[model samples]
Target: MNLFNLIKKDQEYWLVDQLKVSHIPNIEYLVAFDKLLTEWKEQRVAYLSLLMDEENEDWLLKRRFKKVSSIVEYTKVLDGSYIASNTFQVEALSDSRVTDSDFATLYDLCRSGSANKNKLFSIRQIMESLERELGANWRDQCFIFSQDSMNYGISIPHIEQDTTDEGRMFYFGVVPEQRCKGYGTKFHAISLELLKTLGAKLYVGSTDTSNKHMRRIFEANGCRLRDIKGIYRIDIEKEFIQ
Candidate 1:
């Protein structure tokens, strides 16, 4: 058999499906992946697949699977980043104009830096995905940012209501390249402004603690370090037989 067929015949070989947007952290990825595998075991796929958000572009790792025994093995894999558990806070802004070019620029930047080299989707793809996942309720809570005359942009979706006194859940992401250029600050400000206009008293956002740039932006905006959570992962194939 060809190498492809040989690999396929291993039965042990697994296809890890990056689910794209479950919104849980790395440690959670293993739990969710395993649950999914078990729930779909009849499908006959031996390996586990993981799902991640497109915004988690920087945490990719190289393949490093080792055999520990006949059925057990260890693999150190990357599963994006983790967010510190904390109350959400919002910052009000005076502006609310985001352009499509901004999203295109962000997509290009993310693709350029991504390790997986998975093709980045167009603005339409993103919108469709969001609509399918979020349903019509998405319109009441989210908006697309874009430049004049351009139809492409990023989607800003709102999480559930914040449990904190602030009444702000969290916003997902800003464009990749547009980051660190003060656009995030602007975006946050604008989002807060909108939230305030909608009678919200505060807003909150989450990011990987390792993401110094984003942390810095949040700090500069008057957001304080509220909590920290450690993220962990285990290779099932490694843990199961051990």
Candidate 2:
């Protein structure tokens, strides 16, 4: 029905066609769409990506593409209502940075829920890469675990720092054994308070569509659904891309 030339000048995102037609949702559209990707594949685009709203009725039009991931985003308007002064302390990676060896400990604390899935499995790898990517803008943003089982973590983008986006972006994940113990909910609540105290007017977060517990945690913390996107990806294997 529709073909979108989803590309940018800087090429920050993958070059892909976002098909958005609904009336017919016919095979012809899919055939034509496949041709577009084929042409771009010859041009050596970084990856072939597809994005569709979760509510789109014409989803079957691109059913051939592999569904890699989906995101459900929420935003909390903060006026300091959720701030907790006495409970939970959050520190930034930049302010209270950890040594390479010490970061291993933090990584182990976070490993309860991080199985080798779609994401790169190494927590230390992610942490170091994020710290490097954010550079001066990065913050430690960790909870000092009084117990050995789990450590709660949050990433809040600050206005003062040269953070990429607007609003205080925050996210939290709990250990599997530690989950169902209200830690997720408590993390959201305390994060709201921390963001409020830091002068954040709004806090935004997102989770995978499959993560029901996180969805509930955000809802319990007064976050409202803002957007939903279904992301599909085709790996650029030399055999497949060609």
Candidate 3:
């Protein structure tokens, strides 16, 4: 497979998807992957974040890459009968106008003390991402709360991802203050119903193995573990510039 097409480029990192092939990635695949890393180093890639199938997880050791997390893909079929028992004021984010404060708060709540905290994004970076996320074919960012209290948020995809099957939910996060209050359960249930409302036939979401809090929420919603993806990262090799 072509490594170039599998990457989603960003200012800080290039997010790669877990490649699932019928046959194991042989020596040629490793050579190509190493070559890609070499080229990325020369291009100042800085960090290479790889999402790989469990089958291919061991192969990265050949390149001295370390595993950061184990990502599990959870999926469930939507029956269109889901309903949220709890009432939450759901607000859709406006595409044309999102402020820095909005992103700063959300970023902190989502990443702080979590698996992705090390991979930080500034307020400007968050806003820049919002600009891309709210563009055409992108779904709405829905924030759930009650009585002006900010609880959490969930995002629905307006278009299918090339890496996964149709009808996907991009992400959901509970605020730091609201953690362990069963807010995630309520928000996740509401999200499932909302996804069904948005015509999602199958709901797919992922979380790292170490993120038991988020995994519990997914489990509460009856989401099953379908695949285990190995997450790997490597610093750019300055000496490999040649």
User: What tens-digit string does per-residue lDDT give for candidate 3 at 1-242?
Assistant: 55333444453666666445556455655666777776776677657778776666767776667877777888888775544466676655544234447645665566566654235356466555654654543425544344355436544343244533345555567667767988878777777776665666788788877788888888888888888777788766533545
Q: lDDT per residue, candidate 2, 1-242, as tens digits?
A: 24554542222225343444556555565566567767655665545566555554245335445666677778877764664433545555455545546645655665456422235225655565445443555554443432332345544444323323335543356655666877767766766665665566777676777878878888988889977766666544543533
Residue-pair clashes per candidate: 14, 7, 0
Predicted candidate 1 versus true structure: per-residue lDDT over 1-242, tens digit per residue: 01110112134333333322335455555465446545434445444333233232233222223211111111111122212221233311113343444544544444343223122345555555444444565445554444443322232534323222232422334555455566555554445455454554444454554456556556655565543322222244553563
- After best superposition, candidate 3 residue 51: deviation in angstroms? 0.7
How far in Å is the alpha carbon of 236 misplaced in model 1? Answer: 4.7
TM-scores of the candidates are: 0.42, 0.63, 0.77
For model 2, state the Cα shift of residue 76 in Å: 1.6
Error of 1 at 110 (Å): 5.6
User: Which residue runs does candidate 3 get wrong by more than 4 Å?
Assistant: 1-5, 10-12, 21-42, 95-100, 115-120, 133-139, 148-158, 163-165, 238-242
Query: Once all C-alphas are superposed, what RMSD does model 2 give against the true structure?
Result: 6.4
Span of ten consecutive residues with least summed lDDT in model 1: 69-78
Global CA lDDT of candidate 1, please?
A: 0.39
Model 2 bad stretches (over 4 Å): 1-51, 55-64, 95-97, 104-125, 140-165, 168-171, 197-199, 238-242
